[model samples]
Target: MSIKIQDLPNRAAFDVKSAQDLRTQFAKDPQQGLKAAAQQFETMFLQMVMKSMRDSVPQDGLLNSEQSRFYTGLLDQQMAQNLATSGKGVGFARLIEQQLGRTVTSPGELSAPAEAANTAGNALPLSTSDGRHLQYRTVLNNLPTSASYGAPAAAPAASNGDVPATSKDFVNRVWPHAVEASRSTGIPPQFLVAHSALESGWGKNELRRADGSSSHNLFGIKAGKNWSGQTVEATTTEYVDGKPQQVVERFRAYASYEEGFRDYANLLRGNSRYSDVIGSQDGTEFARRLQQAGYATDPMYADKLSRIINGPTLRQALIG
Candidate 1:
């Protein structure tokens, strides 16, 4: 049962507390009412999702490509439905604008903030709930003073089917996980890092959730099921064949880096869609196969990944 918003004593200016509130409103509600509610919340959720899409959503300004078709399809059809059903779009957007002190013109404009949401656990410069850019002091405070609970987990280093060097500790820490991700998901390590860096700013983004809590999520991977960690209710994308299909989900969080690293690594290893890359023994071939296998929504996703890997920034992030 969803709790009534009024039942909650003190809520931030634009907070909606219970699924029941949404359910009573939309999970199962009358058509007219749902439409009205969606009108109100549509803008707000768009604000949330736009934060991520601003960067990820291609802006060639023309939707000639299949990727653009899928992207727009999600925005116009899928996301708009959520706004009507949730019934808090205006209020939420208003709150964000108030805190950030800038009006969000379109959902796409929110990419910076969404990307910033990825590295909430580690030190990263970001905006506060009230919308002020600041250091990641909150992250430092959330970490355990001692590793009494468990040992620090380090993912295995990624070998390019050759001798894997360990000179660059920064890249080394994530490469193991990346290599595993590449091997399991067929998403190349550089592609994953570039995406992660774009998503979380190399552990300097998403210091916390909108609710003022530690969200222990890396890669901004949302909670799907069997999640037993901190959570943030937010709108995110659901990709089908690498195309955005628009999904608003509750994301799970972690308390330690080990948990996040392990979960991400395993996510790829376990999912069968990514099984082809498992121990394939070729980097470029792995990338090509992933694309051919329809790993992303875009018909040209493999091409994009190739370009990203071959790009200067991604190459440096990988080898350095």
Candidate 2:
């Protein structure tokens, strides 16, 4: 069967239909399918790169309008598609095709690489001034379901606060505090940073005060009746009977990020609930203990936190 690349739907955006179609094509002709899939990955990567470049430029000029921006986006998408299909894409597609050809034996095995490609496009910047880009060395397996802990549940909603534009910024800002917290709790500094990133969406979704200041509640610790600290009220999602429900709750606030980290360390050290969490060097085990001890209501909390701790996002941010 001759594969018609032009017939693929949602080529520029992530869609379930596109993935299904790719799998079907792979079943018929593995060689051509691998090429097509690689091209698709390159197209997504190029689009993300172009979008990031456009975002960096000022958009407040008089000539910039909503319609113009919309059309410009379309133009970028088409350009990305053309570049990938023209066989001259910055070598990403070629590299992916070669890599897949060596290890991929059946169509069923294509999902891992396909999902990894999608994740890479979403989580990575294509290039920096030094011409460095994020590289995928291997395909990541699907995370295990949260059934071991209890019924499967949705991930928690992100906290409401400002976030840095890049992962590097997030890591740099929190590294010192993470180090201090790690010293007190015996948890790895990167683990603490990853936990904070999961809770606050890499500092983007932290709890904020009425005046739009940060609550500095990096761990999402709530204000209880015995607590006498400042608090910020925010709507948060809690899992009830395996369903998500939103309710307002008061979270502990801090004067600074250091104070927040210090409080977090104290909580882990002072409370008996987190006895297993302290001094745990392994990221996966630490996250698992936190969930098992009712750190958050999200059933997938441990899995989500573990992903950040072990995933490429943190690795890239730390290196960059």
Candidate 3:
């Protein structure tokens, strides 16, 4: 049940080449690569701890001889390796794994459908072999800062008028990414557009920062604890005790509408509570399940979304 130090192996001979290989591997397959790198980091960290402990001991005795010190360093390195391999060292690996795990998207995971892939004019780009040019990368790269607050949004579609000129315009704007999202979740693109329209008040009332710039949070998704991105605080209407109440809530801010749509799709697909809504062909059923799953504070959230799905917006958009 116990590990003997005498039986421990020598320190691993990790070098610059090994480090470069790990970085390359992490870029290719994150789960395996991150786990491997994390283990190595833990081993190094444990070695540092062991070295520190050895250094703190007095050097005035027979044990402080040059040969003894050399043997002690070797022993400490072996002890660190043993502790790391046995899962008894500090949990640096787990922490690194957790942080890096979110960035790993599977190959073809976010690919668009056949229909959307063929559609040209949309901002949502197909993932390349390198994946460095993913459309959503714009969101992470162009994060909102305080100075950028209240600045004009990049897209002018929402700023044209009270309501969009036509539902076709909104559909055209989000359709490609909607298809991409649908390919992942099996929810229809029309339904996703309808949901976004409802959440954004037909593109009239997107969440805005203090200076009145749009947050592009088409889903009205509130910022949660795990949200490490930029946010916008805005007054929102919520149903409390079956009565409407105004409250300022923090919502996730995105660099663009496409980014917001992508996040929305991921939110529903990633969450277990929204399991009933995912892959449901029936828009009505999806709406009802999303509401039932506590997607919105409004008790009539399903009804409102259902109306949007069945309304003239969708009707006209479908006809076009």
- Computed on alpha carbons, the lDDT of every model, listed in order, comes to 0.42, 0.66, 0.60
Off by over 4 Å in 2: 1-162
Question: Lowest lDDT 10-mer window, candidate 1?
Answer: 143-152
lDDT of 2: 0.66
Candidate structures ordered by lDDT, highest first:
2, 3, 1
Scored by lDDT, model 1 comes in at 0.42
Model 2, 1-320: lDDT tens per residue? 54476554334432223433544455555566666667766776787699889889998899997557756876786788788877767898788777666644444344465555545542221111211111221221111111000001112223333456667667756665675676677676778889989989888888899999899898899999999999999999999987899999999999998899999999999999998788665567789889998999998999999999879888666544
Each prediction's TM-score versus the true structure: 0.36, 0.50, 0.50
199-307 in candidate 3: lDDT tens per residue?
8776677787776777878888999999999999888889988999999888999987778878988999889999878766545667888999999889889999999
Model 1 lDDT per residue over 1-320, tens place: 54332333232212312212432332232232223222334433463455456548665776465445434543543444344335434454333224333211222232354335334433211111212212212221221111000001222343532222322333445444454344344343545554444445444453357865546455567666776767777655456755677766687777754466567667657777756654432234455666565444456646655565546654443322
- Steric clashes per prediction: 23, 2, 0
**What is the C-alpha local distance difference test score of candidate 3?**
0.60
Give each prediction's root-mean-square deviation over alpha carbons. 22.2, 18.8, 21.3
For candidate 2, the C-alpha RMSD (Å) to the true structure equals 18.8
